[model samples]
Target: MTTITFTVSVLCLLPQSALARWACVRACPAACTCTQEKSCSVLCDRSGLAELPKEFPCEASAISLEKNRLKFLSERAFGTLPSLKSLSLDHNNISFITPGAFKGLSNLLELKMAHNDYISYLHTRAFTGLKKLLRLDLSDCNLFSIPDRIFIEQTALKELLCFQNNFRRIPGAIRGMENLTHIYLERNKIEAVAYNSLLGLGSLRYLNLQENRINVIHDNAFQDLLRLENFYLNDNLLSDLPRLAFRGLARLKMLNLGGNQLTNVSKTWFGDLVELEVLYLDRNQLLNIEEGAFENLTSLITLHLNSNNLSTLPFSVFQPIYFLGHLYLFRNPWECDCSLDWLKQWMESYKLVRDIPCAAPPSLAGLDLSQVVFPAVNGTCVEPAELNLTTASSETTATTENRFNSLISKLLQQELREEMGNGTESLRNDTLLDSEEAQLAAGVGGRWTQSVQSLLCFTLTWLLFGPLHLSDAGFWLYCT
Candidate 1:
C-alpha cells in the first residue's frame, strides 16, 4: 500500500509541472515572439496584424508592432501593460487614434508612430495616460495641426519629432512643455514664426525648421528659448528679417540660414549670440554683408558664405571672429582686387580657407584668388585700373580708355598662350586681334560701359533722393 501511494504522488506532480509549462507558452500572443531572458520583449512586427494583439506577457517591458496593417487605435487599445516602457507602431496604416487610446501605458517612456502617412486626425485625449513618456515620434505623418491639448499629459516629454508633415505653423500645443529639449519640424509648410509660438519651452536646446516656407519671423519670436543651442532655418523663403529677431538667444551655438533669399546680413541681428560657434549663410542672394555683421561672434569657429551673389565682403566683417577655423567662400562672384587683398593676408594665417574663384577683372576671370599674386605698388596693393573706372575723372577718361584696351590685349594674349600650350599654332597679336577683337571687344566694352553708366546713375540717384531710394536703386546697382 505504501509503494502504491508514493507512485500516485509522483503521477500527480507530473501533470502539475506540465500545466505550468503550457501556461508559459500561452502567455505570448499568437504569431508574436516573446523573450524573457533579460526583460520581456514582444515583437509582432511584419506579422500581418490588422489590430493590436491581446494577451501580451504581463511583464512585457517593450513591444514592437511595426510594419503592420493597423488602421485605427480604439480606446484602451494597449490595455494596462503596466511594465511597458517602449512601444513601436511605426510603418502602419493607422489613421485615427481615439481618446484614451493609450490609456493604461502610464510608465511608457518612448512611443514611435512614425511613417504613418494616413494619421491625420489625433483626438485631444489620445495620449492621455502616457505621463512618463520621454520621447515621442510622430514624424512622416499626415498631421496638418496638432490639437492644443494633445500633449497635455506628456509633461516629462523631452524630444518631439514632427518633421515631413503639413504643419503650417508651430503648433500651440507645444507652447508650455517646459521640459522639452529637442523639437524637429523640418520639411513642413510652416510659413511664419509668431512671437508666442514658442512661449514656454525654456529647456529647449535644438530646433530644426529646415525646408519650410518660413518668410516672416516676428521680432522676439525666440525670446523664451533662453537655453536654446542649435537653430536650423536653412532652405526657407526669408528675404528680410527684423532687426532684433534673434534677441535673448545668448546661448545659441549653431545658426543655419543657408538656401534662403536673404539679400544682406544685418549687424543688429546677431548682437546677443555671443557664444555662437557655427553659422551657415550659404546658397542665398547675399550681395552685401554690412560691416560689423559678425563682430560680436568672437567665439565663432566655422562660417559658411559660399554659393551667393557676393562680389566682395567688407574688410572688417571677419576681424572680430578670431577663432574662425573653417571658412567656405566658393561659388561666389568674388572680384579679386585691392578690396580682397586683406583676404589673401588672412588666408595665410588660416590654411583651411576654401578656394575663391575670381568673377571680374577679365585678367583674373577664372583664377583662384588665393593663388593669384597681386602686384604691390609703393608698399600698397592697388586695385586693377580696369576696376577703377568708377572713380576715373573727365581728364583721365582718355587714359582709362587706353587702360581698357590694354586689359583686352592682355586677355587675348592669355587665351593665345593657353591655345598654344594645347598644341595649337600660335598667331601674331595683330592677327589674333583682327580675328577675335570684334567678338571679344564688343562683349567686354559693352559690359564695362553698361556697368560704369549704371554706377554713375546709381550714385547720382542716391545723391539726389538720399537714402530713402537707396534700397530700390542703390542696393541692386552696388550688388550687380
Candidate 2:
C-alpha cells in the first residue's frame, strides 16, 4: 500500500504551473486564504481559529490574522518569515505573549496588536528581534501597565499610540527611545505627571494628554522636552497652575486649557511661552486675571475667554498682545458700562470680536457687546489727589505751594499762565472754582468739545501704556 501511494503522488504532478498551484494549495492552512503575486499575503481574519495557522508561503510579506480567537503567542510563533514587513493581529483575544514570541521577523516595520481587550501584560522579551520596527499600535489593549523593558530592543520605533488605556501615570517604559516623535495618551486614567516622567525622549514633538483625570503636574514635568510644540490639556479637572508649571516650553505654539476649574489667569502661567499663537481659556471658572497675565504672549493671535465668570477686564489687558486677531468673550457677566466702551471701539476697529453678548445689568442682558453703545461718562470718578508730605510742619506750607506751582507750570501753555495762577489761588481754598472754570473752558469751546479732547487724551494714554493716575481731579473737571 505504501509503494502504490508513492506511485500515485508522483503521477499526480502535472505541468510546472499546475504543479506550483497544487503545491500552494497543499501548503495553505485550512483556516486561511493565501494568494501569491510578487509577494505572498495570507489572510486568516474572522476564522474562529484558537491558534495561528502553522503553514504559510515562505515568501509571505504581509499576514493579517485579525478578529480571531488567538489567546497566546508562544516562542518562535511565526517561523522565521524574514521578509515579513507588516503583521496585524488586531481585535483578538490575545492575553499573553511569551518571551521570544516575535524573535524571527527581522524586517517587520509595523505590528498592530490594538483592540485586544484581554491583553493586559507582556513578557520582557516578547519583542526581541524587531530592530527595524517603526510604528506600533497597542491602543485599547486593556493594558493597565506595560513592562518597562518590553521595548528596550525596539530602538527604531517612531510613533507609539497608546490612547484609551488604563495607565494611572505617565509610563516610564519609554526611556531609551530617542527617535520617538509622537505619543498619544489621551482618555486614560493618568492622574498626574512626575518631574522626570519624560526624561530621555528628546525628539518627542507632539504630546496629547487631553481628556484625562490629570489634575496635578510638578513644576519640572516638561523641563526636558525642549522641542515639544503642541500640548493638549483640555477636558480635565485642573484648578490652579503652579508658577513655573510651563516654564521650559518656550517652543509651544498651541495650548488648550478649556473646560477646567481654573479660577484665575495668573500672569506667570504662560510666562515662558513666547511663541504661543492660540490660547483656549473658555468654560472655566475664571473670574480674575492678574495684570500683565498675557504680557509675554506677543505672538498670540486667537484668544477664547467665553463662558467664564468674568464681569470686567482692564482696558489695557490686551495692550502687550498687539497682534491678536480673534477674541471670544461671549457668555460672561459683562458690565457694559463705561469700562467696556474702549473694548467696543476696539471691536469696531479690529473686526474680529465674536458673539460677545452681555449678561448683566437688566438693560444690556442679551445685547451683543460689540454693537452696544456705551455712555462716555458713565461711572467716571474724579478723586482729589493729595501730595505726600516729606518736610517739617514749618516748611510744609512752602513745599506744598512750590509743588503746586511746578505742577501748574507743567500743565499750562504759555498763553494760559495767567489763568493757571488764578486757578492755584482758587485751589488754595480747597475748592475748584467750578463756575469760573466753566466760563473759561466755554471761551475755548462748548462743554462737549472740551470734554471730548481731554477724554481722548486720557483714552490714548491708557491704551498706549497702562492705567494713568492724575494728581488733580480738575484735569477732567476742567471741561465740565
Candidate 3:
C-alpha cells in the first residue's frame, strides 16, 4: 500500500504595523544656524565644517549632524538654547569633544552618538556639565574601553545606555552613579560584571547583560543590588549559572537565561529572588529541571520553555504558580502519548503562550492553529480523516479501485513466479499458508480492496475445490 503522502503549502500572513508614524517635521526652533530652509531643521549630513554654527536664527529643538566630516568640536560650539532636548551626532568623523563644547544646552535630555569613527580618546570631565541629561545613548561608537569617571557628576541621570560600544569589563565608574536606574551594557566585550562594579547604584532597576562573551560570574557578584528589578543574561557563554548568582536581588522582577549552554537549573539556582515576575529558559540544552528550582518565585507571571529535548513536564513542575499567565512549551520532541495529557488543563486555562510559532508538526503546517490549538489535543489524535474507508472511497472513487487492481496485478507478476518448483514450494508448503495467502491478497487495501480480493480468492478456491470440468461448470453457472 502507498503511504499517506501529503503536500503542505503554508501562507503565513504577516501583520504590518497599523500605526506607522510619519517623521516628526515640526518647524525649527529659533536656536541654531541651519543649512536648510529657515522653517525646516538643517541636516548637516557629511558637511565638512570644523565647528557648529554659533547662532541658530530660527526655532528648533533638535539637530541631526550625523555622518559629518568634522574632526573636533570647538569650545562653546553649542550656543545657549532655552529648549533643546535631543541631539543626534551619530556616524561623524570626529573623535574628540572639548570639555566645554556642550556648555549651554542645559535642557538636553537625550544624546545619540552611535556608529561613529574610531573615538580612541574621551577627555576627562567631557560630559560633566549637563545637569538634566536623563538618557545618554552611545551604542556602536568605536572605543576600546571607557573611563569610569565620566558619570561621576551627572546625578540626575536616570538611564545610561552604552550598548555595542568598546569595553572589555564593566566600567568601575558606573558603580558610583546612584541616580542611574537602567544600564544596557549588552553586545559589548565585557566578560563579567566587575567586582563591586554595581555596588552603590541603589536605584538601578534593569541590567541587560545579553549577547556578550561572559563565561562565568564570580560568587556574590550581585550581592549589593537590593533594588534591581530585571536582569537578562541570555545568549552568553555561561555553562552554568551560579547557585546564588541572583542571591541579593530580592526585588528582581524578570530573568532571562535562554540561548545559552545551560544544562539544567540547579535547585538553588534562584536563591533569593522573591518578586521575580518572568523567566525565559528556551533554546538551551536543559535536559531536566531540578525539583524546587522555582519554589520561591510565587510572583512569576510568565515562563518560556520551548525548543528543549524534554519529552514531558515533570509533575509538580508548575505547582507553585497560582496566577501564571503564559507558558511557552512547544517544538520539543513530545511523544504525544498519555504522558502529555496534563497539558490539556494548562492549555485550556491560559490565553497566551510561547513557541506557538512551532506548535504542530511541520506536516500539519497548513492547518490553522486556531482550529486545533486546544487543551483536548493533548490527548490522542483522532484517526486521520483521509484514511476512513468511506472518505477514501468517496475521495478516490472508481479510478482508485481500478488503479489498485492494476497495481496488484503488476506486483504479483513481478514477485510471484511459476518457474522454479522450490519458489512455489516456499509459498505453498508453510503451515497456515492459506491464512497467509489470504493476508497477502488483502494487503493492497484501497478503494476496492475487498472486491478484488474476493474475486481472486473465489477464483483460486473454485479451481482448488473441484475438477476442471466442475470448475468450468461452476463458473458458467455463477455467470448465468
Instruction: Give the per-residue lDDT digits (tens) of candidate 2, residues 41-130.
Output: 778899998988885766668899999889999888998888789999999999989888887889999999999999887777878899
Order of candidate numbers by lDDT, starting with the best: 1, 2, 3
Q: Please say which candidate is ahead in TM-score: 1 or 3.
A: 1
- State the lDDT at 346 in candidate 3: 52
Tens-digit lDDT track for model 1 on 1-480? 999999778667776545434433568899898766556788899999997877677677899999999999988988888889999999999989988888888899999999999998788888998999999999999999999998888999999999999999999999989999999999999999998999999999999999999999998899899999999999999999999888899999999999999999998999999999999999999998998889889888999999999999757777787458888999999988888888887887777776899988887899888876767768887676543543465436555446445544554554556445732354343344443334333343434445455446545654665433222433553534
Note the Cα lDDT for every prediction shown: 0.83, 0.77, 0.65
Candidates 1 and 2, the one with greater TM-score: 1
Of the two candidates 1 and 2, the one with more favorable lDDT, higher being better, is: 1
Clashes of each: 0, 0, 11
User: Which structure among the candidates has the greatest TM-score?
Assistant: 1
RMSD of each: 15.8, 15.8, 20.5
Cα distance off (Å), candidate 1, residue 255: 0.6
lDDT of 3 at 273: 75
